[model samples]
Target: MFVDSFSRWMKLYGMRRKSDTLAFVQKFLADMSGTGVPRSFWMDNGGEFVSRDFIAFCDNAGIRRTYTAPGTPQQNGPAESAIWRVNKAGHAARLEAPRLFPKIDFTRVPGFGRDGERLWRESCHWAAGGFNRSPTKANVGRGTCV
Candidate 1:
């Protein structure tokens, strides 16, 4: 997940494995078109973020990487704060969805069977979309509804 600090626009990507981060980020940048690559990225020093491929990807794109201090999530600022709200919204959406949608498998609701994790991921994706479209006080005049 990446959030624009000024506008509060968010980009969420669901990955099944750590190795998938680079691809997700690359695709995101490609999809961004005119925005061009970011000057720097703030992220925790997780293995995935520090992986050789990820490092090379950033270097190739001329994106400087900044890592949060170990064991300190607050250093990530807005991105860290937004995560919990995203999760809460997702959980609520998943739980109340049956009531809201009633039928329609509600548009490709995945067959989770016993895989509880995938369900959560799908809900997060759903909520992220809602969040992007829904208006928020912070974004009202700061320039976002993306």
Candidate 2:
């Protein structure tokens, strides 16, 4: 949902890391493929989603990419919800370890870069698996989402 190489803000003297665009895209594709690709994908005007390689990949995969107008993120509600969930979960996880503070690098794992990219890929795999196993309020029967 959030397709940026990094989204960390400089709080003081250090940087907040974020997931790389390539890794996120690969995981996103894998996740969607498992559930059946949607008819369309809504995105922002970020360079990450507009990259030549990304656009070509989407085109080849027969996925339609829809971009929201500049400064109009509300138009992408589903994506915004997904991004909010990811960020909220990540932040909640970090908050549980407040004692670590500046000593830890929570954002480092999710952000871009060789190692960070790998971490993000793994996180997606784990997340998808977990979500599939977990029961959803929308589901009426006693079965997993996937």
TM-score of each: 0.80, 0.52
lDDT of 1 by residue, 1-146 (tens): 88877656788877788878888998889878688778888999999999989999899999999999999999988898778878887877666766676664644655533223447777787777777776667656343344
For model 2, the superposed segments whose C-alpha errors exceed 4 Å read 2-20, 97-137, 142-146
Cα lDDT, all candidates: 0.77, 0.53
After superposition on all C-alphas, the RMSD of every candidate to the true structure, in Å, is 3.3, 9.7
Q: How do the residues 1-146 of candidate 2 rate in per-residue lDDT, one tens digit apiece?
A: 43221221001111133326656666666755655654556678888778888788788878898899999988876556555555454444444443556576655544533223324433444444344455555444543543
lDDT at 126, model 1: 72
Candidate 1 lDDT for residue 53: 90
Could you tell me the C-alpha RMSD of candidate 2 in Å?
Answer: 9.7
Q: Which candidate is the best by TM-score?
A: 1
Candidate 1 deviant stretches above 4 angstroms: 101-118, 136-138, 141-146
Candidate 2 CA-lDDT value: 0.53
